[model samples]
Target: MFDSRHIQTFAEVVRTGSYAATARDLGYTQPAISQQMKALERAAGTPLFVRAGRGLRLTDAGRLLARHATGILSSIETAHGQLKAITRLESGRVRVCAFPAANATLLPATVARLAASHPGIRVELLEEEPPDSLRALREGRCDLALAHSLGDDEEGVIQVPLLDDPLLALFPAGHALAGSGRVGLEELAAERWIAGCRRCRGHFLAACARAGFAPDIAFTTDDTLAVQVLVAAGAGIALVPGTALPLLRHTEVVARPLTPALGRRVSAFVLAGHETAPVTALLLRTLSEAAKDLEPAAV
Candidate 1:
């Protein structure tokens, strides 16, 4: 069998195109680098390199090995990293995918806590809504996902409930219902509506339907800040999640709890068997803690 160190030397030689250069880079003698290549070629039962004047040329077998070298090296590196992290729990990376509201509200605190507690652990964040975030988690693009559902059970993954983010009604400060402690969906049926993301809009439609009216949607946008801006301009009223209320930038807009209290359950999702992964588990705990902090004050 070809030794991994020999394969490493071969890949380096392929990159630098010089045995002498590879040796210099890897801190070995030139003859040692050449000997390692000979071993690799013998294990493969084929000539991997050919002499071409003053330079070396890769034979067909060498080209084939080179094609696979990158992936092989990457897998080996990842395995080593995982082993090291398992041994120390001091260094690792966790990629997280979350929706905008949770990204704004929960991720900052979660990342901060993780950084303070485990300075060597790094977090990479991406923003995607529901099914997409879940897809990313399953595809291995993200280690964790902050996803929300309107009471439907998500299959094919481990789900940990974080919090229920209530949907709040937003109106212009001077609007008649703005001063009300709680506004019923049907009460705003005649007013022009500004819709948010697809999921949020779906929830809004469902809530309005339950209240016996269809909203007259005049504007649609996925940006919470824009929704607030529109509401402040008296362009249209909107329903925004409580977690996103803290991001409200327009003072002319007022938020109140919905009469029936519609909400989405926010949760952390991981691959079915990976919930106990060290870094991911740490993040899950941090997210739960952050959500608890937001619970009492949200909206």
Candidate 2:
């Protein structure tokens, strides 16, 4: 419980071996130096100095405190410097959780931009879909989350809209609807479907329900590549986000926009009070810019 200021005065007194000289060196009056020593002795429960004929001599307790003061002060200074760096965006770490499609499309560009602009700000990425990413964000495991929702609101987080990822219809190259400019959900009502992650499957089911028919989902997987391969092999047709298409598209799979244009809204989520944190704000801005760059291809 020793005061830092008292410890500093004590260290200077020990070094100078004279109360008046220590006060002069520290720009404090000699009586002020003496008061600090008395207070420090009270906190330490032992004497820190003994009179030594017009000078000062350290007691055993004083020597012990002096031995450790340098390290303590150095650690305090280091902490201050690091905090300043973080405030200036010269050094920091941001943990980001995102879905697979966003990892493949949006993250690369965003990370690249951050690295180019702020090399000292490190980014760590984890892959998880909407609810899971949102869960991670709420649980304090991640600083930010790149999640997409079908117009659903999440609780306890601030959502910053980034882009709209339209769902595109996928079919085998020679399928009857492959050459169509656009296809409606009702037209494929009888076809077996390849569904993706849980949220995506839910979106698919809802879109189908709105179209007035239930789809028979035959295959389920989270991998976009596998989804494309299944559609190419004619196992079933599927609907995938436009962001996922550019990352992995099978040559024999034809992708066309859905006639009714079903899509999910992608956003960056941060804890309620963390939106203005330096690293978090920088990442949010970079993500928005990256999403804008992908607009032409995403639609």
Candidate 3:
């Protein structure tokens, strides 16, 4: 077996082009570096390096070992980083996939809390809808997935309840129903509507159906900020998830709770068998705390 230290020293000598420099960089004496190289050559049963005019040059065996050493050393370093991260949540990366609303509201606070508590940890947030987010988690593209669904357990993924976000009505400030304490879907059926995302629009459609009317959808968009902008411009009213309120950039829009208290449950998804990871568990705890602190919607 090729000793990792020998391979590491060999790679360092190749990079630095001098045994003395490699020794200095690695905090070892020049003789120690020469001993490691000689041991590596004996293990290979060949002279791995040859003396050039002023520096050491790699032989064919040395070149091959150097190429393999680079990848082996990289993998070992990555493993060490992961192990360290697991041991103390000190350093590593956590990739998170979340939908737009959750990214806007809960995720920011959760990420902030985790980052403050564990400054060495790196967090990556990707925006994806429920289905895509779950897919990313299953494909190993993300460590955690924040999703919104109608309280259904998906196969192969474990769901951890994060929050129950109510769907609310949003309209321009001057709209007749804007100031209402609560708005019924049936009451606004005749007005033009800015349809939200596919899932959110489906929920709105179902609610309108239950209320015995079909909404007149004037436009469809998946962007929460754009929805707010359209509503502020009086393009139409919208049924927005409660979490989207924080993303509203337009002050002309007013949010009112839906009369029947319709809502979707937001949950975090991870591979069914994998949930005890140290960084993931830590972030999940922070997310739970942020969810608990969220303001409850008025019915």
Q: Give the whole-model CA lDDT for all candidates, comma-separated.
A: 0.87, 0.88, 0.84
What is the C-alpha lDDT profile of model 2 across 113-208, one tens digit per residue? 999999999999999887889889988899999998825566667899999889898899999999999898889989998998565577778789
lDDT of 2 at 64: 91
Worst 10 residues of 1 by lDDT: 148-157
- The sequence of per-residue lDDT tens digits that candidate 3 reaches over residues 1-299 is 78988988999999999999999999999999999999999999999889998898999988898889989999989998879767798876789999887888898888788778888778899998878888888889999999887356778777889888888889899998888998877888688988866665676787889999988888899888788889898898888888777676787989998787888888888887667878778878888888877746422
lDDT of 1 by residue, 1-299 (tens): 76888888989999999898999999999999999999999999999999888778999999999998888888989999878876476888889999998889899988888888889888999999877898888788999989887356667788899988898889999999999998877788799999976665677787788898988899989888888888999999988888987798788999999877888888998887788888778888889998999877774
- Top TM-score model: 2
- Give candidates' CA RMSD values in order: 8.2, 1.7, 7.0
My TM-score estimates for the predictions, one after another, are: 0.73, 0.94, 0.73
Better of 1 and 3 by lDDT: 1
If ranked by lDDT, best first, what sequence of candidates would result? 2, 1, 3
The TM-score that candidate 2 achieves is 0.94
Clashes of each: 0, 0, 0
Off by over 4 Å in 1: 1-82
Report the Cα lDDT for candidate 2: 0.88
Runs in model 3 deviating more than 4 A are 1-82, 295-299
